[model samples]
Target: MSVTRPVAAQFEAYNKRDINAFIDCFSEDFRGYRMPAETPSTIGKSALREFYISNRFNNPELRAELISRTVLGNKVFDHELIHGISPTPLESIAVFEITDDFISTAWFYFP
Candidate 1:
């Protein structure tokens, strides 16, 4: 299976704020992190759900549009972004490590 399909599905869920659907795109042992300081990693579905909820509450109009997607074996590098609050959009690069079940890991960067 190509990473594009899963990534696209994730984007769909994210746009809809469908937490169940969004988290479904991740593996059972999924872990994610935002760069700069990575000591405390977000592990498991519950943690990720909290992250999404907080984000949604903070930025009600947040939405990501894929700028580009590159697949390398089990990994997918997605350059995308969120918009609506500020004039200039916030850029993000999601490094997705996919597994048989779902995406195992994600590392995000904003610059």
Candidate 2:
């Protein structure tokens, strides 16, 4: 399967806030991190689902507007503006590493 398939599915699922579909785009051993930190914010499909449900998907206004995207090998880099999590639109870059057609790891960046 192409890396873009999962990445795009995840992106669409994110906007829809469909926890099941969102989790489906990730691997069983998924890992998510906020950059500059050594520890992952969430790990494994179960934890990833919990984190997004409680902290992200719960916010009905939460959404990410994609500015651009670049794909290289099994990696997908997305530049977007996030809203509903803060007072102002937050600019961010989400780097997704896909393995075996699922997103295995992801890193969030703010610049």
Best by lDDT: 2
Specify the poorest-scoring 10-residue window by lDDT in model 1.
55-64
Q: Candidate 1, residue 102: CA error in Å?
A: 0.6
Q: What is the lDDT of residue 87 in candidate 1?
A: 81
Q: Model 2, range 27-89, lDDT digits (tens) per residue?
A: 999989999889998889999988899899999899989999999888999999999999999
Residue 65 miss distance in model 1 (angstroms):
1.4
Alpha-carbon lDDT, every model: 0.82, 0.93
For model 2, give the RMSD to the true fold: 0.9
Error of 1 at 106 (Å): 0.2
Against the true structure, whose TM-score is highest? 2
Off by over 4 Å in 2: none
Which regions of candidate 1 deviate over 4 angstroms?
A: 85-87
